[model samples]
Target: MTRSVYVTGVARGDGRQVVELGVMELLTRQVDRVGVYRPLVHDTPDRMVELLRSRYRLVQDPATVYGMGYEEAAALQAEQGQEALTARLVEGYLRVARDYETVLILGSDFAGTNLPAELGVNARLANECGASVVAVIGGRDQSAESVVAEVRNAHHAYTNLGCDVIAMVANRVGQGVAAEAAGALRATLDVPVYVLPEEPTLSAPTVSQIVDTLGARVLLGDEAGLARDALDFVIGGAMLPTFLPALTPGCVVVTPGDRADLIVGAMAAHSAGAPPIAGVLLTLDEKPPPHVLALAARLAPGTPVLAVPTLTFPTATELFTLDGKLGAGTPRKAETALGVFETHVDTAELTGRLSVARSERVTPMMFEHALIERARADRRRIVLPEGTEERILRAAEVLLRRGVCDLTLLGEPDAIRKKAGDLGISLDHESVQMIDPQTSPLRERFAERYARLRAHRGVSYELAYDVVADVSYFGTLMVEQGLADGMVSGAVHSTAATIRPAFEIIKTRPGAAIVSSVFFMCLADKVLVYGDCAVNPDPDAEQLADIAVQAAGTAARFGVEPRVAMLSYSTGTSGTGADVDKVRAATGLVRERRPDLMVEGPIQYDAAVSPSVAATKLPDSEVAGRATVLVFPDLNTGNNTYKAVQRSAGAVAVGPVLQGLRKPVNDLSRGALVQDIVNTVAITAIQAQGGDGDRPDAGGDGQERTEGGAA
Candidate 1:
C-alpha cells in the first residue's frame, strides 16, 4: 500500500503551507519517490502545486496532481452527493498513489470553496484515500488556552470522521503563547501537537508581489531585487532628511511621482547600505525624469523601482492584503518557511508516526539539504577572507538566512559596507561580524604569535606585522588561535595565497603525510569523490597511499561510503609500467595499513564506475564498479578526467576541497558561484566539527558523519 499524508487546515489563515512545505522536505529526505496530490484545487494550474513540483522536482503530471476544481467539487457535492465528489477525488489519488512510494495529499483551502463543511470534507477525503491526517488550526488573535482548545477540537473532528490523525499543529500563534498552547494541547490530546509561532518575515510580501498587485511597471531591478521581502512600507510625504530616517531594512518607499527628492534619497540610502529598502513605489502614475531614474540606477543598480497608477493612500491600503508566498519564484521564502518549520516541528517524532522509510539513494537536493541541517546541528563559526567581494557577500546572505553557521567576514568594515551598499545587500554587522585586520585589537597579538612561530626561519617582527595584515593570514591566525572554527578563502586570490598561511601556521595533522585535494562530482542521482585532483601533481607511492587514506577519510566525513579505487592506465597487472607500479604499491600500502577498508588497485575508469565493464575486467573485486572514492594516479589524470566527466555528464564539481590540513581551511575557485561558496563554507564548518583528534580514517571506525562536499 502507498503510505500517504493529508495536510488539512481547520480554518482560513491557518498558515498550512508552511506545514506542507515542511512535510515535503521531510518526505524527500526520507523517501526517494514522493508525489503530491490535491483533492480539490481552485484552478487547473495551482500555484502551490507548481511550487511543490518545481521545488521537489516532481515528475507527476499536472493533470494527475489534482482531481477537480473546487467549484466543480462543490457543485457535485451540492447536486449529486458527497460520495460522488469523493469518488472522483479517490480515483485521481489512487492513480497517483500507484506510482509513488509516498503521496502528500494537499487538502482544500477553506477560503474559496463553497462546500457545506470544509473540515468535514477534508476528513472524508482523508478517510477515503486511507491517508493519515495532520490538522492545522489557526492561533492568530486567540488566547493560549483557546488555541489549545481549537487544536484539540480539530484532532477530534478528524478522528471522529475515521481519519487517523497523526499530528495537530497550532500555527500562527502569538509570540508568547506558542509554548503554553503546545503544553496545554499535550495535556488535553494524546496526539502530537506542534506549535509554530507567527513569523512576519514568512508572511511579509515581496516587491514582486506588490508590483503584481498594483499593476506597477518595474523601472529597475533584476529578479533578485524583485524577490526581496517588503517587511515594512514607508510613505514618503516629508522632506529628504525626514523620509530617509523612516526607511527600514526591506521597507518599500511609497511616494507621489513628482517626489524625485524622496526617490533619490531612498536610492542613496540603499546605496550607502544604511537600510536596504525593498523598492520604491511611485504612486499617481507619476515617474521621475529620465536623469533621476538613471541616477537611481547608478546609486543602487538592481534595487527595484516601481511605478503604479494608484495613489499613495489607496496603494498603502491594498498593501495589507499582499503577503509572501512559498512559490518557485520566491525561493528565499521557501527556505525561511522550511527553517521556521524545522525549528518548531519535532521531525524525528513525526517521522516515526508517518513511518516513512529511508531512501536507498541520496538525491542531490537531499544531499544539499542534509549538509545545511548537519552544519546547523553543531553550529561553528567560519571566517571568509574575501568578504568584500560581491559573490562572497551574496553567499553570506544565503548562509545566514539558512542558519548554516556563524560567519565572521574578514575585511575593512567601511569597504565591505560600501561594496554591499553598491550591490544593494543589507548585511547586519551585528549578525555577521566584519573586522578590519589592520585595526583589530588582535593585530599585534597575531603578529607577535606569527613572529614567535617563525623565529626558527629568521622571520623579523616587522615582516610578521605586515604579513598579519593580509586577510588570508589574519583569518588563518584566527582559526589557529581558536577565534574562529575554520576558514574559506581564495575567491579572488590564488590557491597558494589562500592555503599558504595555513601551511605556515596550522601545519599538517599528526599522522597525515601531505595536503591533498578532492572534488565532489555531483551527478544527477549521486555524488562521487575524486581525489588528489587539485594538489600533488606527481605523488610517489608513499604520498599516493597517504592521499588515498586522506581522501577516503574525507569521503567518510561527508557520508559517502568509501570504496577506494586506485586508478592507473593498467588494470590488475594487465599492463606494467612506472605509473602502474606506483598505483599497485599504494594499493598494497592501504590494504596493509587499513585492512577494514574496501579497496581495489590499478583500475581503468570505465571498469571502476560501470558494472558491466567491472564484470568483464575484475569480477571478484569488491570496490571495482561501486567505488565511491577514486584515487587518481596523478594530478594530470585526475584533473582532466574530472573536468571531462563534469562537462560531458553535466555534473556539479563542488571542490578541490583541500584535505590533510591541521585545521579546517578550504579554498574556492576565483569564479565560484554564490552557491558554490556557500557549499564550501558549510563543508569547512563540518570539517571543523570533525577535527583531527581521532582521524576517523586512521581510527579504522568507518563511520560516516554527514552528506556534504569533499573533505
Candidate 2:
C-alpha cells in the first residue's frame, strides 16, 4: 500500500543505480513496477560497480550511471558488457520518480559540509517527482546518533514534502552496539524506527505473489495459490502432446493423461483463481484417482476439463503462450471459492479470492420491461399498424426476417405483400396472413363493441367496422382476444392516436389508475428513470404518486433498484403551494402506500444530489440524495426537464418505455427511429414473461429489494 519510498544513501551498490534497483526489487512487494530514480548520484565508488552488476542487473563495469548511463537502459552497462544488455538491466524506468510505491533515491553524504549541492539535487528530484524521501544511512563502523544525524539533516534538505518521513531503517549495525544505537536513535528521531536485519531479500515480492496477483489459479503444486506477480510454469505436461495446439496465452496447467487425478485436480484448481495452468494433457483415460478427485471437488468444481491422452514434455512449447478467459457459463470459480480460500495459507491471495467479485456485466438496464435477445435466439411478435403501409410492413419484415421478432402485420395479406415487395420487405404472403378487416372472425364482435361505444353518434354496424378497420385497432382486438401476445404501433399515428385504441381494447393494468409513460436515460456511466414525461400533461397529486411508484416498479423489472425521488424546483419544504405541494403530496402518498420504497423530495436539484446539501436538508432520508427514479411535478417539467438533462448531460434517452398497458402492448412515435423499433420490441418481449398482463419486475418479482443496491 505504501508506494515507492525514496531511500537516501547506499551501503551495497553504485550508491546510485544499485539503490534504485534494490528499492524496486523491494517495492514490487505489493505495487507493480514502481518507478526508481536517483535525485543526485555523485560518488562512483568501484564497489558500487559489482553491487549494480549482481543485484541491479548492471550490464557494464566502470559505467557512470549519473553521467554516460543517465538515460542508458542499464544506467551502469559499461561496468557489466553486451551492448544491448543495458536494455534489459534498467529495462523500464523514468528519470522522474513518478508514482512509485516508494521512491528510494541515493544521495552522497554531505558530512556537515557546506557545498550542499548533492543533498540539494536529490531533494529537488524527490520534490519534482513527488516522492517521499527515506534517508537510507549506511556506514562501515558508525553506530552513534551522529551517524543517524545525516538522516535528519538530509530530510530537512527538502522543504516541500507533503507527507513526512515515515521511518528510518538502521542498516548493518553490529549486534553488540545495536542496543545502544537503537535506544538513542528512537529517543531522538520523531519518526518510527526500523532495524534492517541480515535478511538479503529485503522486500521484493516473490514470483509466487506475482503469479497469485494475476489471479493465477494453479491446478498443480502445493504452493499453487501463492501470490506472485509473475512466475514460470511448465506449459504442458508430457502427456497427450498434441493437445498443446489448443493452448492460448496464460498460466500453464500440468496434468497426466488417463489420470483423472490430473484432470480433476487441474479443473478444480483452475476453477479457483490460482495462477493459470497453460494446458492440460491426459496420459490416457485413467484420471481422477482418489486423492486428485477429492482435491478437484474442493478446487475446480464444475470447471470444464479437457482430456488429452498423453504425457507432459511434448506439449511444453505450445502451452508457454496460454492465456485464460473467464466468461458466462464458465464456472465462476474464484467467486465461488471465497469461503474456501479463507482457510488457505496464502492470506493475501485468499483475501482477494474471498472478496466479492468485481462486476463483469453492465449495471442493471433501467427499463426491465422485457428484452428479446435482439441478435440471438430470443424473438417475439411485433405488430405494425395499418396505414403505416411502408414503414410498418418494412418494420415487421425487419423484425421477422432478421429475427428481431415474430411478425404480425395488420393489413390485408394482398395489400401487405404488394407493399412489401414495393418497399423491399421480404415478407411472404404466407408469412403475413390476411385478417380481412371486413370478414375477420372478430369483426362482428368488434363492430358490436365499437358501435356501442360510439353509438351515441348513431354509428351503424358497417360504419363501426369501417372505423375499427381504419386505424387497425382490429389488430389490437386480436391482442385482446389472446390471438397475439402484444402490439406496437404509432408509425403513422401520434402517440395518443396509437395508444387510444390499445386503452379501449386491452384495458388498464390491473388495479392501476392512470397509465403513464417513462423514458430510461442510459449513460455510459449511469442510468436514470424519468416518469410521465410522455403522457399525462398535468397529473394531479394522486396521478403523480402513481407515476412515481410505477416508474420505480418498472425500473425494478428492468433490474434497477428504485430509489424514488419526487422532483420539484424546491427541495424538501423549501417552496410552497400548488407545484411544490403536488410533488410533496405525491411523495407522501408514495411513502404511505409503498413504504418499502425509498422515496424523497419536494427536493431541489442541488439538495437531491450534493450530499453535503442533502445532509443539511433531509439528512436522515435514505433516498433523498441517491434517488435513482425521479417523478416530476407535471408533463411540461418532466418532458422538457428530462430532454434538457439528456441533451445537456449527454444521456441516451430510451423509451417512453410505456408502462401500464394490458399485456405488453406499447405505442411508438410516428417518427420512430430504427433503434427505437428495436428497443420497443425488446421492451415488449420483457413484458411477456409472466402470466400477469402487468409488467412484473425483470426477474418476474413484483418488488425491488432495497438492499440489493442495483442501479
TM-scores of the candidates in the order shown: 0.94, 0.46
Q: Each candidate: what lDDT?
A: 0.85, 0.51
On TM-score, the candidate that comes out on top is: 1
Which residue ranges in model 2 land beyond 4 Å of their true spot?
1-370, 374-380, 386-398, 401-404, 412-415, 422-424, 428-441, 452-460, 609-616, 691-711
True-structure Cα RMSD, model 2: 22.5
Q: Each candidate's root-mean-square deviation in Å?
A: 4.0, 22.5
Model 1 misplacement above 4 A:
414-426, 429-431, 693-711
- Per-model clash counts, in order, read 0, 91
Winning candidate number (lDDT):
1
lDDT of 2 at 686: 59
For residues 452-493, what per-residue lDDT tens digits would candidate 1 score against the true structure? 978978888899999999999999999888888889998898
lDDT of residue 496 for candidate 2: 63
Cα error, residue 14 of model 1, in Å, equals 1.7
- TM-score of model number 2: 0.46
